[model samples]
Target chain A: MRTLAQVVSWLALAGTLAPSLFYLAGGTTLAAVKTWMLVCTVVWFVTVPFWMDRAEKD
Target chain B: MAEAPPSSAAEPVNEYEREPVPEKARLGFKSFIGQYAGEHTAGTELMIGPLFVASGVAAFDLLAGLLVGNLLAVLSWTLLTAPIATRARLTLYFQLEKICGRKLVTLYNLANGVMFCFLAGSMVTVSATAVGVWFHFPMPGLNDFFPNSIGWVIAVLAVGVMVAIVAAYGYNIVARIANYAAPWMTIVFIAFGLVGLREFLNATQTTLNSGADLWRLCETAIWKGGTPLPGQVKFTFWHVTFFAWFCNMAMHIGMSDLSVFRYARKSWYGVATASGMFLGHYVAWVAASILYALQLLRTPGNTDVLPGPLADGAAGVAGLICVIVAGWTTANPTIYRAGLAFQAVFPRSSRYKVTLVTGLIVAVFGMFPAVAMKLLDFVALYGLILMPMGAVIFVDFFLFPKLGLTSFYAERTGGSFNVAAAIAWFATLGIATWLVQAGYTQIYFVSLPGWFIAAGLYVIVSKLHQRLAP
Candidate 1:
């Protein structure tokens, strides 16, 4: 479960950056990048809490 | 049956505030790296980056200045601050108490705490800008000093109250959130720069086929060096360099970070500050500058440097969220620290109440836009005010024994105040302030001479005091 959460967190991190890369490279619209980032942000906050503070607990 | 008093050894220690950190508790280099990175890349960077653009810094000057200045800052941490932190393994407060005495350290705490409140207030202003984006309220402009509208006041108050309450009650939760948000916020800041650059290119219909073309774009469209905006100091390469180097002078040269670095296993771990300097101060500052430049290109007459509108224009809602999170994360700790400082001054006071009051005071400061708008000057002044005591500590630690005077004079004498240290701090401040007021030096450059002045005064005064008192 922790591994899954970590993987999702990493992907969400990548997801936040990916749209901007696409926008900068000229294919995607700024609107699309914004939308994608918002989605990634939600995913991040949801999954990250599961594992982000676990190290301190252990 | 009354339970036997809990074993003193079983009680968790209070971060080793009054003693050296035990070897078993020393942290690795990576801990400092992550900490520095998160702490530096904050809401204020958004304000600072835009202020650089407003100051009319050319591309070469900004880039080269930041490169050299940040290098100097990192070296200061590694050489000046870290060695003492590792050798003594003590908090800055405790170290200062040893050298300057308890009463003087309390005075220093008051100064430090007040400065923290103002700094946190600026963060509140930054976050409030985000609130303005949603609420369509009139926010403060670069030159405006007062709250401009009812909506703006409400926005600031709401944000400030939320932040204060969280800091007062849910500090641990906010800290955890800050940790989770750090990496994400950093990436968003980078995205702001990229998206702003793309927008500028599209607006200008410029194609970057070569390095020369990009340089031309940056020089012509981005950092077109010219007269500074009204009420801003014109930035030269020297100004940029000094600003970057001394921006955190209080932390490094002022030895505030001794508290943070005391847990390090090795002094060289101070080099880990590079992660923060380069990523937050360099890249984030440059990125923020690009966004502000884009704002100017779009509306030549609109000179308001609101981070919320700036971020929103670049990355939309994500940008707004970035600004708020960045502001809140930074402000949370700052408010907490300020509360602790205040609580120390009023030892019997409840920490939660002190922190809540401190947060509200910061919010009030936020309502006035001048603090955030003039952040460059405010930061320089903050560093200058706190920097002299660092010199005192340095001299007391290294030079006193050589001069045949005892180190930790106050500790040895069991005094509540050390007159020599007090003279050094106040006299240096007076001289430095006079120099700036007399137009002999800019605030950005005053600290260099101020630091030397402080060291000299400390030694001379200590010599005189010891001879007379003994």
Candidate 2:
């Protein structure tokens, strides 16, 4: 479960970054990039907490 | 309210304040990398990056200056700070107490705590600007000193109170949140730069087929070198370099990061700071500068450097969240540290009550926008004031033995204050202040000479002090 959480978290991170690159490359609108980033942000917060702090418990 | 020893079998020890970090507790190099990357890429980067643009820095000056200055900063951490930290493995406060004595350390703590309050207050101001974006309140401009409207005042008050309350109550939770937000916030900052760059290119109809074309766009549209805006100084290459290098002088030269690095398994792990210097100071700062430049390009009249609207314009809600979270996370630890400083001074006070009061004081400081507006000068002054003590510590640690003088004089003599350390600290401050006031040197350049002055004074005064004693 933790590994799955970690993978999902990494995807969320990538999701946050991809839209900006797409917009910069002239492949997407600024509006679309902003919306995509906002969604990725939500996913990041939801999934990251499951694994990021596990070291403390270990 | 007595603090537990680090070696106590109890759960969750109080960070080994008085004793050396145990070998088992030492952290790996990766820890420092993540820690620096997060800590350095803070909300203040938003203010600082924009201020560089306000100072009318040219393209090469801003770029090359940051590159060189950040390299020097990383080296300072590796060579100057980390080596001492790994060997001593003691907190800055404890190390100073040994050398300067309790009374002098109290004075130092007072100075440190007050500076932390103002620094934290500026973070509150940064966060308040995000609130302004959402609420459409009139935020302070780059040159505005006071709260401009009732709405602005109320917004600052509301944001400050929320931050202070959380800092006083749930600091650990906020720290965790900050850690989680670091990677996301770092990406948002990159997005800000990219989006700003694209907008600038589109608005100016510039095509970047070559490196030269990109350079031309940066020179012409982004950081056009000319007269500074009203109430700002014109920056040269040296100014950018010195400002970048000395901006965190309190941590590296002033030895405040001894506490953090003391837990490192190896001193060379200081190289991990390059992640922060390059990623945050270089990338985030340049990105923030691009955003501000775009603001100027679109509306030639708007000179306000509010991070909230700026971020909102770039990446929308994500940008606003970045501004708020960045400010809140950085300010939380600052407020907590200030509280600890204050609590150390008045040992009988409850930590909760002291932190509550400290947070409220920081909130009051936040209400005035001057500190945030003129952060460049404020940061320089902060580093200048605290840097003299770093010289004293350096001299005592390295040169005292060679010079036939005892190290940690106060600790050796069982005294509450060492007059030699006091003389060195005060005299250097006085000289540095005079140089700045008399226009002999700007605040950015004063610390270099001031360090030498403090080191020399410490050696001379210690000779007389030890000779005269007994």
Candidate 3:
């Protein structure tokens, strides 16, 4: 469970980073990038707490 | 109020720096949400929002850039800073001391504490401007470096002393005041935009009959994006985005908030930063910008960004009070943080004494208008100065072990200074400073590359240093 949680945490970070890098590089139009950013943020936010709980459960 | 932890000869009554935060003392997500929202939506927003206008950022760039950048900031807090905080559960100073040794951490503490003093001082200046409104004092203009009137100095001293005394008591008072003020200040900030929108509609004689009309009005009247006023940097989309992301680099990427987040029950509770990033940075900044944009439209000649008169124009006495309280709430915690940083240096001293001294230093700095007037550049520079150390922390924490080098080498080896950490910090700073001086990039762009530089340097230097160690 801890190993899985660590992997999930790493993947969540990557998911968040991808859209941000895209935005920095001007990869898409404003609306598309904005929507993607919002989605990425939600995904990262939701996933982290679950990962944290699973990892920290003693 | 939370009482001091019990003291013993072995385990003292101090906030335990060398140990993990006990489960009993760990706070929940709501606590973090409240603190971040209150701290971020503050006097600085009033100053920063106007700076975006002064630098001539367009509506789309300013709005979109903030949305993207603030999200990045939130993620940084969540991923980079909070994970370390929860795992280590030590103050930044204590963590650094373990990794970088006592001597290096002391230097870092001095730098951090001094920067906090200047930052808190700027807030005192903000609150003093509102007081200046009441006293009918000749407030400092945009270019004015020194106090313009005796009333200005007296008001600053009074506000500074009050903020100092409160901070000396500790963050419980600061947090309480901030929680009470956050909701009300959030409303006033919203009102600032609504009232400004009404005035803009009236003055321009344009009705927001449609979404297109509102967009059109936003383009024409608000954030038109042209030549910045003389002496201000021209802001592009990248500039706005980077500034928004890096503005609090000291706290997020620089890992200063390792102390704040260390109290969290779980690392992912860092998602709570969204409250501050969105409400304070996004909403308050836009509202304050709207106030400045209105002033620009009304009197193009007066480009001086004064939050006091601007707030008074929007909501009269309520706006003035909001400005005053916003500055207070912001400065109080900052002074407290500065006190903690100073207390780390003088571990034997009580926090109250250190905090009182920290407040006085801030008050002295508050006497200088330049610090407040040039707040934008000052913030950017401040973040840059402290950021390399954050990179050092990140590298030392995660990457060192992966690279076949021990983590917390200073602690394990019982060394006084880690040469690798020092090189990573100074070398990254040197290269970044050179880049800015050589006109290759602005301060905002350099930190992103600088982080990588520091991270890489730490790894390579650590490999060499460990190999050479007897």
Candidate 4:
């Protein structure tokens, strides 16, 4: 039940944010936006292992 | 979502490489690139570009939006999907099984596999057009759902058989075909771009000019900024932007490619995806659109999007063949993935037999042209349907601890189909569907936020129900 509520809230957030990002970022700076996205991706990739806790058997 | 597999001094937890997991093998960087490029440079481009033209995206919206959107797509794969894939060492299905349980995973696998098949079938449809051009078969019309001519039917069957055979052979075969095809096919894609530029020059009867002139051409000719075809959605810069970004939402945000990237030596291997983003999605998409826009200009009556005709007009028979094979490269692995998903359903079943069966299923669906005909909506719906489980997997992997729940809780708890995951998946869908159906917003635009929604929900649900991973 808690999971369900969390999912709902996230979707709501996504709805609010994704489109807003398109607008706020000023879709006009296509190259800059691409660079920004690429940087985000690079950071995400490099650090994911550090942040994630792996699965373990009981 | 399975709790970390118990470890002793003899075995240490593998970080990014595959270790401590039986039957899981880590892959090098090149394989990851082959997989990404091969997957994204789909046969569907022939279909997608024309449809965009049909929708009448203005030149700037289509051009500028794709430039921005595709980069976002590439980033999503690099950032959101790759890191987990390199770290997890499991297929999205297997990892989810650990989190959501076998029953829930089975449902997701079915959806994932089916979506892959439909996607493959469209490629088959694209390839068949080349056969129609080469072999003199009567091609199906855009509105033609069923195989209109005996020749078209034969061509599709022949293409389908080849695709199925290759798919059944396994990943080595799939990767090899993609690798072999990528280089040559990429050249052909570039040629398509150059030819489009040449044709545009001829049409405008003007020498190449400064940026403003090109922008004007985009507004006037390329995007032409028109309403969509009879049943298609209107694509403004926003629609084009999101569509370009989310076209591969299932693979990136949905985490389906976790199966393919688990082999990477480092997550940064994902940067190679730019090869496909630029080569196939960016260059090819724009080039193909130029070709189609040219077609609409030359003969306004020809609404048919068969690549053969478009390619023939752009660069003779060679372009036609490129369109066909481009579809094959993309579709081949997609069918293979679907087969793998189906394989999970009957664990004892051989992948070869499952792929063969799944290929036949898609081919049969191909018989009705509608599957390929309405590809835009099909792809969006495809991503939407499969995405929730992907979200469940991501959250189960990354966010569970933050929620004070054990990751991979299902495997640890000995549950089949984690109840919290199962409920979260459906509940997110139900609500998202409600928003779309009630006209709150469009479906194509939903995936980005929808992904976060499902991910957050999975964790919260895991906490509320105390469902224990099982």
Better of 3 and 4 by lDDT: 3
Evaluate model 1: give its TM-score. Answer: 0.97
lDDT per residue, candidate 3, A1-58, as tens digits? Answer: 6466556645644553344344333354434433443454344444455544443344
Model 2 residue B115 lDDT?
89
- Show model 2 residue runs off by greater than 4 Å: B1-13
Candidates sorted by lDDT, descending order?
1, 2, 3, 4
Clashes of each: 0, 0, 0, 35
lDDT of candidate 3 over B103-168, digit per residue (tens): 888878888788888888888888888887788888887777898889888989999998899878
DockQ rank, highest first?
Answer: 2, 1, 3, 4
TM-score-better candidate, 3 vs 4: 3
Per residue, candidate 2 scores C-alpha lDDT tens digits across B222-302 of 999898888999988999898888888888888877888888899998899888888878898999999999998999899
lDDT string, candidate 4, B1-470, tens digits: 00000011111112432232333545556655654555556667767778788777887788788889888877887887888977876766667777878787788878777777777788788878777776776777767777788887778888888778876775454454444444445545555555565566567774556878767766776668766666667889888788877777777777866765666677887687676676767777777777788877777887778776776655454456567667766666667767867887888998789988888877766656776777777777777887787788777777777767788877887888677788777887887898899998888887767777787777777787784422
TM-score of 4: 0.80
Instruction: Estimate, for each residue in A1-58, the C-alpha lDDT of model 4 and write its tens digit.
Output: 4344434433432332233244222342323333333343233323333322121110
**Model 1, residue pairs in steric clash:** none
Model 1 residue B242 lDDT?
Answer: 91
**Candidate 3, after superposition: displacement of residue B305 in Å?**
1.4
**What DockQ do you compute for every candidate structure?**
0.80, 0.88, 0.02, 0.02
TM-score for chain B of each model, two decimals: 0.97, 0.97, 0.94, 0.89
- C-alpha lDDT (0 to 100) for residue B10 of candidate 3: 13
Off by over 4 Å in 1: B1-13
DockQ of 4: 0.02
